[model samples]
Target: MIRAARILFKATLWFVVLSVLWVGLYALVPPPFTLTMAGDLFQGRSITKDWTPLADIDPDMPRAAIAGEDARFCLHHGFDWRAIAGAAARNAQGRRIRGGSTISQQTAKNAFLWQGGGYLRKALEAWFTTLIELIWGKRRIMEVYLNLAETGIGTYGVEAGSIRYFDHSAARLTPTEAGRIAAVLPLPKKRAAIDPRGFVRRHGNAIAARVGVVRRQGLDACLK
Candidate 1:
């Protein structure tokens, strides 16, 4: 029993160390690389990695993002405990399906972590999420999200997604088009902004509906 206890303690210690190290690294580094992507490369996969400041980005980008990724983004510093608790309870009752990771959490996972949906990855995600919240402010987090989000397998960032989906820059995306882009974030591969299918249309409508809600509720309310 004593030996088992020692092994467990060592494991716990190692995880804690790794968590601290990752957060410290995030605070120090800008972004390890312009692109930390995975999977097979494809045509038209080049990244336009201009370090545009947060202000340069369209307000609708973060607006829709907050609406889609974490409606409570402005209210939460980083983690949304209510959503996390709900996800935990839901996952516990079943085969452990879905998570309540916020936009900040997803950003950390995308930028610094891997793609696996494992418990280990989730724990690491939470650690990095907290790190990003503490190290980077709301503006920095949104800026990073715009740059790192995967619109396609090899394509990344709002600019890339905009170009790929609509053959235009993210700066030029219209409200209707932006809603379409935001709708498929959950299942990007299965949906597209240009798809004539009813599913895409329906999703666009749903996103459009929430656009006003997000605006009227005030963008900052999502931070909690």
Candidate 2:
């Protein structure tokens, strides 16, 4: 019994190590299918966290994103258990809004793992999420998210999305403008980043309200 337990522990350790290596390796090569979407790992570039620094962007941009996606970004170690629990409960009631994966998780999935929703995809994503959160921390994860979120069909990154939609850089995006951008992320084409319709406008306003709350409650409270 003791020998068997020791062997099982060793096997588990190897599996964990291999999984970490797999994610790290994938980060080196761009996604296999290679489409021209947000943060598609342009033809000639190496991976670097500094590729897009969080400080280079407008503060309101991240503020809106955290408000839209993961208000707990600053606080969580990678996973947002509350959001995950809420999503699961909603899914059980047949009212799932798709996903509750945090921004850090999305960065890991997009940068390393494959797309589509499934138990397997989600399991890998969760593991990779934790690994990257430990490896990259909050700021780098946010930087990657701003760069990789699919704002437009062919646009990638806040810089590209800003230019593609607004003909301006991300730094010029106002709070309302940033909210509009955040609104479209869940339904990229259906919601125009620059010219939101009534539905999109409603969503954008909701995100803006969250941002205001964050400002009042403080960034730390927003995470909570």
TM-score of each: 0.76, 0.77
How much is the lDDT of residue 101 in candidate 2? 82
Please write out the lDDT profile of model 2 over residues 1-224, one tens digit for every residue.
Answer: 99999999999899899978865654454233323332336645332221345667887888899889888888888888898898888988998466778888888877766657789878878888988777666766777777777776555577777776788778778888788888888766456777777978998888877877767666633322
Candidate lDDT values, in order:
0.71, 0.73
Candidate 1 global CA lDDT score: 0.71
Q: For model 1, where is the 10-residue window of minimal lDDT?
A: 34-43
What tens-digit string does per-residue lDDT give for candidate 1 at 7-55? 9999989977887786667555546453245342334454444345556
On a 0 to 1 TM-score scale, where does candidate 2 land against the true structure? 0.77
lDDT of 2 at 76: 86
